[model samples]
Target: EAAVTQSPRNKVAVTGGKVTLSCNQTNNHNNMYWYRQDTGHGLRLIHYSYGAGSTEKGDIPDGYKASRPSQENFSLILELATPSQTSVYFCASGGLDRGTGGAQDTQYFGPGTRLLVL
Candidate 1:
């Protein structure tokens, strides 16, 4: 029942421009996350939100920002896009039911958006 979608499946950006990636989910989940996958760096968490109107910085928050306006929408903003930031970005939505003695978190991910910076 949980579905996540991303917009502008592919993007080409200049060295110093800005790029915004959009994501929408239908699960009404409480947590949303943004991640980037690269050759050497592997998959890294860039940003996340606990719920609507709340964005939290992840492990690799530099050069990236996140916005969650509603229960089903989240966006990632690259203020100054660079070549080093060129990679496949993915959005996921899910959360754990922490009240039950530590429930596992299972996130549903959206189709990735490939970005290339020149």
Candidate 2:
């Protein structure tokens, strides 16, 4: 029953500025993730959280950051946005953690927030 929602379906920003993408879930899932989908990069994990009050760096944590203040909210933060970072960002939430021996996770992806850095 995890339903993920993202804010600002589209965004335009200047280089070196900051961009903040928001996400909210209603299923009380313990895991949340942020990913970027680009032309050739496919889906790249940017950051994730195991649960409320905890944020973990994901595979590509170089230009991104994440925060999970509660069980229903997770936010992705771009300290300094760049054109190279222009891409569609997605937020997901699930109850299971595959790496933790939990059942196969059913990640619910958001509609995606398209970011354009100029």
Candidate 3:
């Protein structure tokens, strides 16, 4: 099974400070993603990578950057953190299987990383 885990389950930062969050997956899946969950909105994708050394911006990639250095590691960087960026972040991993539709592939999620920008 695909398993994704994120570091720093919680974080606090001052406005305009820099923050970096990390993620690692054990399933060795080809696809990895970073997302944020906020009130009244479903999970929104920030970035994703198809494989090592390839990062693709998602719908809400603004204010955030991402890096995938290896098959198992992906990092999310907030260069200038703000209170509006405070939210619950999650990492997920999975690969497309013919049996499952591209959008229907079930992504395995990490526990979550909660950020608070003061």
- Top model number, lDDT: 3
What does each candidate score in C-alpha RMSD? 2.8, 3.3, 2.3
Task: Give the per-residue lDDT digits (tens) of candidate 2, residues 46-86.
Answer: 99999999999888999888888899999999999989999
> What ranking of all candidate models by lDDT puts the best one first?
3, 1, 2
Clashes in model 2: which pairs? none
Among residues 3 or more apart in sequence or in different chains, the pairs in candidate 3 whose N, CA or C atoms overlap within 3 Å are none
Candidate 3 has a TM-score of 0.91
Model 2, residue 88: distance off in Å is 0.3
lDDT tens per residue, model 3, 1-118: 5578899999999999999999999877888999999989999999999999999999999999999999999999999999999999999987764555554356889999999999
Candidate 2 lDDT at 109 equals 89
* Highest-TM-score candidate: 3
Question: All candidates' lDDT scores?
Answer: 0.90, 0.89, 0.91
In order of listing, the candidates' clash counts read 0, 0, 0
What TM-score does candidate 1 reach?
A: 0.90
List the pairs of residues colliding in candidate 1. Answer: none
